[model samples]
Target: MRPLLVVGGRELAARLRDGTALLVAVVAPIVLATLFGFALGGDDDPPLTATIGIVDDDGGQFPASVQREALQTEELRDVLTFAQYPDEAAAQAAVDSGAAGAAILFPAGFSDSVGEGNGGSVNVIESDESPLAGVVARSMVDRISSLVEARTYAVRASLEAGVPGDQVQEFVEANGAAGPSLTLADDPVSGGQVDLAMYYGSGMAAMFAFFVVGASARSLLVERRLGTLSRIRAAPIPGWTPVVGKMMVGFGLALVSMCATWLSSVLIFGITWGDPLGVFTLILGHAFAATMIIMLLASRAQTDSQADGYTLAVAFVFAFLGGSIVPVYNLPDFLQSLSLITPNGWISAGLTELAAGAGIGTVVVPALVLFGIGSVAGVLAALRLRKGLLS
Candidate 1:
């Protein structure tokens, strides 16, 4: 045990003195988290608003009613402001000049065509600068058109059912003026909010923790090349002592990287990762998993270059599959399920729960699973290293 501790201490000190290790483990993750957090808009961003131009060529009841209905809708009014234009040309100009995000042109004789039971066509002009606004405008036009069609069908059916022709107009007006029967309202499940900063910060930390441990594990090959392992073998140390020492170094480095990233995120981005105890438990489980997985990969490689390649491949694959590059909720269903098997995924999920104001007990199951994965990998790595060293 003393020999293992000494070996681990020596390796850790060497890693600390190396500038590359410090840069990869501590500096790069923080910088990337900051850039990503800023690039993606935060919760404080103002709500989207756009102006829509309306060209009333028909100047008739249907077009007037459509405009009146859209303007009166409270939900649409919040995000959409209306501007009246004299003609299609002026509306197009408004869109081109960025004065309007989109335009709806009611063609001449539009009301006459609809009154004759022939559907009228409405032309829409959109601006390239405001695509989201254009989508909203398009949806609005489609909704109004559907409502008019429904009213026409209702009036036709009432007339066939022996209702007076004068009463058909009343029925159309009553139904057209009515609002939707059902509307959706948002009800969030989580008690707390997770902004872009907290999300990406946790993702970057989980992804980089693998690199931190990988570097330490790869150092075994470096020491072997330098005849350091041979010199150590000549001493009274056991064969497994060096392997345990290397594992210790990798595990220690992983923990340091995770903690540093957490601190940096809090200081720079003002991110609050809820429940300090939960965060620490997640970090411990994730660090252990990263260290053992990298140790297993390094133990299989014949050379330092091969180990480096393995480390890069495994780290990136795990990161991508584990929601480091994209949110798990946004991933395809198959990929979301696949993430459950990765240590990175477990850590990301734990962090997300924590950010949502879940207690430390919420992360216990994930932490246990991570520890289980690490234990299996650690056993395999130990066995493989023991065989190689004895041989």
Candidate 2:
């Protein structure tokens, strides 16, 4: 055990000194994260929005007031294009027929409720055909509702406390929003605080995990081709000691490479990879699977050249189909469907969920898939390695 540990530890140290290894694991992820950040607009850029239908059925002035302000407010003007309707039926039909992704129907008593210091039920007709647009409309409605609540509750409380009606209106008007509003700063909260950095970082790291397989193939297959395996088999140590030591060395280095990428992305890029457990769980599974599969392929190849080619073929093909180079979401639906079979897609999907503030329950499914891949591949590799080497 001590001898194998020493051997494995030495290999880990040697990997630390390799410049190309460091570049793949650390520098490349940072560079790609930066590029994606730029292409997607800066960290502060506003997200996409849709034109939401607005139906003003109120006897009072709440819907009219919001529309008036929407025309004048710079923030609202930029994000929201509101098409006003006379009644709820028209607005609801727009959503139902897919003419509008979402609609906000202000009830007949909406403005009256505000004057009476009571809350009204806002009828939201959101479309299933445009889920993201529906979400944005819902958020907009929530902010507007909160503004109305603040003003209504304040005015009502003041009137009940015996303040003059005109005085209460003046006070409320002075402190409250000129109209309901939204801001660019509030947008990222819908996802997480740092989405851009985490998105690219996850893709880059998952793609680079395959590079460690290249390193593994070179380490093990080159040694075999040089007769080093036969020499080690001749040693007086237990039959499994040298094999376990070599496997440990390769797998440990792969873990370190991935961890270095993950940490640097968080520290330097300001990416908040939500849920500590979620982040590490997917990364650990991905690393183990990549390392094991690479070793298995390398063990099967008869020569160093064949192993190198095999490793590259598997890595690039997986990376392409999994969306490391091209986004899977942008691909045709059939191709996107196919990405589910690849570990790259599974890890990328789980990381994307983490970036969106998902926790253990949301990410455990992908981690389990990765674990299954690693376990099955590791068992097969072990069986094949014993025959390939002991013979």
Q: Pick the candidate with the highest lDDT.
A: 1
lDDT (CA) per prediction: 0.77, 0.70
Expressed as tens digits, the lDDT of each residue in 41-117 for candidate 1 is: 34454566778898988888866676666667665556668899999889988899999989988889887666544
| Candidate 2 similarity to native, TM-score | 0.63
User: Scored by Cα lDDT, where does model 1 land?
Assistant: 0.77
Off by over 4 Å in 1: 41-192
TM-score of candidate 1 against the unseen true structure:
0.65
Which candidate's TM-score is highest? 1
- For residues 1-391, could you state the per-residue lDDT of candidate 2 as single tens digits? 8878865676567666776556766677657766776675345666655667887778577676655665565644555577777777888788888777788887788776776567676778877665444655666577668767786788877888898876876777776633346433332323233465566666777777777656656666667778876777687867666666767766665677667767866776565777888888888888888887887786688887887788788877777778666666446668978887778888877877667666678788999999888888889988987888546
